[model samples]
Target: MSIERDHRRAAIVALLLTALLSLPLSGSVLAAGQATPATTAPSPTPDPAAEALDRAIAYLIEQQADDGGFVGFEGVSDPGTTTDAILALKAAGIRGVATESLISSAIGYLEDAAGEYASSGPGQAAKVTLAAVAAGKDPTQFAGIDLIALATAPVATPAAGTPAALVGPGVYGDDLYDHALVLLALAAAGEPAPAEAIDALRATQAE
Candidate 1:
């Protein structure tokens, strides 16, 4: 999964570089051609971005395990890593091909591991929810758990002056990563995020 993520990151960088290069070329072309072109520039060469994306997809396919899950550094198939692989494949526009089979396997792995993830933490639930939503699955019914609810459930707040009060209500006692992921998951799932939670996150940034 890490490998897939790294590959995806590289693909993005390649795309950015391609865009930057195209900008100067576009200006030069306009300057050189004041009149309409006699012929269509003989079909421009293959895009470097597309090539990079193809390479990334191939690398991801090679890393897929027998069970459809992309094994992580731990040499185990877990929901987190599997989800990462799925998202990376989707980003590369690799659906409806042999890659789809790999994605299906990863989904199956996540479904089977739902019970374990449910008890993990809000962060895990948020990430899985985002993955499911990205793959066109219903986050509410994923792994028989309402992942959105699990990630957004409000935490009890202690009275003012108590140590627990420092965290604030509706923050879930989770760190910034959890809060940001929950917000991202909510957006991906097309659900409304709690305003209090957003406010709490904003307050934390001020500190």
Candidate 2:
């Protein structure tokens, strides 16, 4: 009798399992279950890179001041860092209405500060120029000033009729980093860097 009872119980369990398995479980049913139900499916595994990017973007957004510029350790709204952030977002291909508004406000700040930027060194000017160009703004006409021209003004041009590298300090900034950065920005702006600037940068590499 006990053996018969056990066989009956097992058959009932198998029947219930078969009924559940045979139910019309379509993809839509699974998707709907996954979408609203915190239960039917296993939770999706979070991507580490995506999570990190979200955190980084959030941090950057949080650092923005009312002027739409980011602040440095000095707690002062710095155009340099702000430009860095803008270029970063542009490079990452981030998009949205909020992002566009954020970038626009930052550009507005740069525009208001363009006079001071015009008077700054080539390195600083080039940074602003790149940031402006990346956002589809005209560096030549930004704030009624030609940022591209301003950026390249300090670079020495190759002596007329000569393809020789410039002697002495090739760039106006404190080091070659400025030279490289300015050259890159100039290229991005669709402006050719001075011949001397190119030669000077090339000259840095030992032959």
lDDT of 1 by residue, 1-207 (tens): 999999999999999778666775553355432764666558789988777777888887777787777778887776788878888877665433346666677888788886577557777888888778867899999878888778877545433443332266666435677778888888889888667877777776644
Clash count of each predicted structure: 0, 0
Per-residue lDDT of 95-167 in model 2, one digit per residue for the tens? 3324677678888888887679656777788899888987899988888988877776644543343323334
Q: What is the TM-score of candidate 2?
A: 0.68
Report the alpha-carbon TM-score of model 1 versus the true structure.
0.68
Give the runs in model 2 whose Cα sits over 4 Å from its true position.
1-43, 94-98, 155-174
Cα RMSD (angstroms) for every candidate in the order listed:
21.3, 8.6
- Per-candidate TM vs. native? 0.68, 0.68
The models' CA-based lDDT, in order, is: 0.73, 0.74
